[model samples]
Target: MPKTLLDVDGLTVRFEVKRGSGWGKKSYLYAVDDISFEVKQGETLSIVGESGSGKTTAALAVARLVPAHSGTVMLDDGNVLEKQGEDLRQTRQKVQFIFQDPYSSLNPRKRADSIVREPLDNLSEKSEDEKTTIVAELFEAVGLRPEQMKLFPHQFSGGQRQRIGIARALATQPELIICDEPVSALDVAVQAQILNLLRKLQREYNLTYLFISHDLGVVQHMSDAIAVMYMGKIVEHADRISLFTSPRHPYTQALLSAVPTVDRTQRAKQKRILIPGDPPDPINLPKGCRFANRCPIAEAQCSQTEPELKDVGQGHKVACHLV
Candidate 1:
């Protein structure tokens, strides 16, 4: 069996909201609700969902950036959420985060070199010369020239700025990298370059990635395993090929159908499955399955009881009454 690099069980995150002035109702916003999943060593597990589906929140909770209201995020043997102060800081070095906006993630005032080297300076006891050497090596690894390290973030294009972010994430030699919509902001051509770089790095370094994205196209290219999220729960989880070719849940089917097909003949035969109704309010979620309101095949039973993620066949799991 492949060793699990990360394991998340019963993970839930709830945000409190103010109801009115003076006093507020502590309504829970279940950003991530009772989610359980695992990433094996050196594998890319892409979490896909519509906006506000809790993909980003799940990633943040895994990295221990946001407080997990309940459940455990076990990184190798350690529970990341339980650690604190120095222990948490040390554990964080093993799990780096690559934010979505390269333009905002990078320091506009600091040189690119400084931004990349910042991790090394904070985590490692490396000397000034050692930090410089490491930063230069990282630049080369990410396909950036060493001389360009002195330039500010604005000096590079959007894709290049992302590469710099990648370099910084690599600075600490983390075992797992949580990428939150890493390529959504880039052009189609630029997205490919960054994706290729990430794949190459993962192969060379045996790095595990938890990629969060709403774009099914990019998820198909980068993910070994895909987990589809609806509302705050995982609607389906399966291998890339399985999920793409044989989506069981209505939400997953609808999401995959929306991805534009290149073959005109296939596109002609494909019937687009449009999801109706806006997403339910997180603060006041409907009873039973969250996707019940939007699900095309929703039955009366779906509104009465929530479905649990159950195995169907060949490691495929789905949460739907019909499935």
Candidate 2:
């Protein structure tokens, strides 16, 4: 097995929410509540949930792009959350982010070559000529023509813009990449191309990915391990096959049941597990089980106390009172 590349424990990220224009008490929104997970070297671990479920928040906090309220992010070399000064700068070179929106993420004023060269500029002391050579190589690496390097962001198609973003993320030769729904903004055909490209890049570079997405099909295709999030918490985490075939968490089961299938027999065999009620407000989460209100099997005890993530063996973990 590969060694651990990232180990996060009890990570909590909070934001102050103001309800009124003035003189109102400030309430905290727990964007990412105390959650823990790890990524193995060269493996892809995906965080999947509905919108506002904190997958993106967790990833951002891990990348140190956002300040985390609490917890430790342990990398193989050091704690990512605690680094400062030059140390932090050096640590950031080993981790990169691929943003969700290709349109907004790239600076329209900058050419594709310049955009990809930005990360290398920040991380290294390479001269302009060397940087240009490296950028040309990266452009070709991401399947973009080197001739298109001088083109601005607006000159490229949506998929090509995303390729530029990918090239930028790869410029620093990062070991770990935090991809926050990187392909969601592209066309369906383009999404497939990007996915295949990511897979190919991972194998070629031995990269570890912390991929976040709402699409289960995409998660299934890309992830080796999966974490199911609800109300800013990880309710279930398991190896890919186990989570897909035998998910234990109520939320996870409900999520898988909703995935559309074409086979009539398979569809008949799979019982739909619809969740009841909308998710709780993040600003004022429930005191006990966050999913208690919507869980079909939740009992009186479920709402009275929070459940710890318990190992159910076979590399599966679940957080549920019933389980």
Clashes counted in candidate 1 amount to 0
> Could you give candidate 1's per-residue lDDT for residues 1-323 as a string of tens digits?
67999999999998877776847657778899999999999999999998999999999999888899999989879999899899988997999999999989998999999999999988877799988888999999999998898999999999999999999999999999999999999999999999999999999999999999998889989999999998899999999999988899999988878888898986997799999879888888889899889888899999999999999999999998898
Candidate 2 lDDT by residue in tens digits, 1-323? 79999999999999998887869788999988899999999999999999989999999999999999999999976999999999999888899999999999999999888899998888887898988888888889899987898889999999999999999999988989999999999999999999999999999999999999999999999999999999899999999999998999989999999999887987998999999779987887887899999999889998889999889997789998888
**For candidate 2, which ten residues in a row score worst on lDDT?**
17-26
Candidate 2 pairs with clashing backbones? none
Off by over 4 Å in 2: 20-25
Query: Native-vs-model 2 lDDT?
Result: 0.93
Model 2 / residue 253 / CA error / Å: 0.5
Instruction: State each model's CA lDDT, in order.
Output: 0.92, 0.93
The runs of at least 3 residues in candidate 1 whose Cα sits more than 4 Å from the true structure, single-residue gaps closed, are 22-24
TM-score of candidate 2 against the unseen true structure: 0.97
279 Cα displacement, candidate 2 (Å): 0.8
